[model samples]
Target: MLAVGAAALVLPLAAGAAPTAFAAPVSAPVLRAPAGGYEELMVPSKMGPVKVQVQWARHGGTAALYLLDGLRARDDRNAWSFETNALEQFANDNVTLVMPVGGQSSWYADWTSASNTNGQKTTYKWETFLTEELPAFLEGYGVSRTNNAALGLSMSGPAALRLAALHRDQFKHASSLSGPLNWNAPGMREAIRVMMLDAGRFNVDSMAAPWSPAWLRMDPMVFAPELRGLPMYISAASGLPGQHDRPAGLGGAYNTANAMGIEVISMVSTRAFQSRLNTLGINAVYDFPSNGTHSWKYWEDQLWKARPHILNALGA
Candidate 1:
């Protein structure tokens, strides 16, 4: 029974193996201006000031995408920031890139009673932040806010949908790659436990007691009814390779083991969460990449693939 922290901290995602004995920092060329656009912004967050930096190729068009991060992904660098170069890939695609920063493990939810607002307990209000705050603030850049899409990796997968589901009028499309679709599942509790414990923030006694509802309240499945009518793109690396060094020998029996062991990310109890999305009558561009795992390689490919479909949904 670890004591949950009074000050919740989000552990960042894996970035190019830290200055290590084997791998060096990913060296990619800078996203040049004139052909690409870049900006480092300080946006307001429920926790504190957030710094968002983005670079994208400049092409003429109305396509836009918003990206969020996972718990282990930090503001400093994540798979995309340190390993994969985003601006280099989409610079000439005529798509506008919008990134709102500082949500490592925050789940991009609007806190109802966790954050501080007007000397009162408040919700993180992430919904308002992305849908209303950031868009309104970035409107000065001559970018259209009409039918933008949201893309996220890991924990942010659901966040992307939560945004679109809650504010469908604002986002024309939603896409999640390598994200945990079922948070309420029994299999999820262990991962969540490991995550909270590793971060020195765990309290089983408080599970679903008080503030816990806020977390589940933000899960997309809870809002599935609203999410069903939207155009979505979902992908996972099913029957895929595992993470870096995880093996089939390490008792790959537990949910976490299978998740980190093989590259295939799935639910043991309900393996077809992706297919279930189809059953809901929402048209989706779904891909179960062969031998894929939870890594930047999968994310980069998934985002690149989902680009056109999303843009078209936005009427770009």
Candidate 2:
């Protein structure tokens, strides 16, 4: 079995593809934007008013790209804002960048039950919020309910695809950056359990029962057939340290080691996911780097690579 401890350290921490023929570009809706480039939206959901940071679409276009955070999603701000330059990079793109903050260890799923641990009181209803509530609210901002894409890293990587798979009408484009697609894979549940517990004192059982249908419901491999025609970009890197894995100190070294192991796990699962898609005759742009770790630098690089495809798919 893999060492769950080191993997857990990064689980709390957080691909390239060629062009695929996507659906016909959807026309942009009339956009409503505050003069400020960015706006904070309080979207109401079963969990309560969830905070979402929106970078308005540039040039008056209304196509949106939803960016989901990792397992250790911050309650204060989405890490994409601070960890990467995504906001500025997409500043001039016609697509709106919709980032929902604070879903730590939630996997962006509709949980089976509430976890009172680590002060989590409300039942997680992220699947509903992202698919149903958020879309309805964004429609008022002139963002098309149907013109959008979903991209995520680490924990949310599988989530991005799952969201697109189950709700194809909402997310036309989907991408996973170093996310393990198969949850039912051996040792995956234990790793997830360790990571979830370390990240937020969360219990995996509260999200889904062991080997339950709910678990399979979230497994991308199981839903691979659903992803048949969607435009997809998937990427992963070898666990070996790359240029970005340079350590500043002992703590940095330790974190780097954890990140490496985590990436290896992701790499394995991603390949399995790719095999499943291949078997299903689903086409996706796949990138497997020679060396890298589970860090923001690689995810940033992959996102930049995937940006063009995302814009094209959303017709942004």
lDDT of 2 by residue, 240-261 (tens): 9998877889878878877887
Give lDDT tens digits, candidate 1, residues 1-316: 1111101112322341333232232222232222356666666555555555555436545446787766555445434655556656666666667666444335676654542212323334667778776666555454456768888876688788888887877888898887767666544555555554443243322333332665666655666678776888887776445443254554433433334432343322123555566577756677775555455666777777887787678765
TM-score for each prediction?
A: 0.74, 0.91
Task: Name the lDDT value of residue 53 in candidate 1.
Answer: 56
| Model 2, C-alpha of 264: deviation from truth (Å) | 0.6
Clashes of 2: 1
Model 1 scores a TM of: 0.74
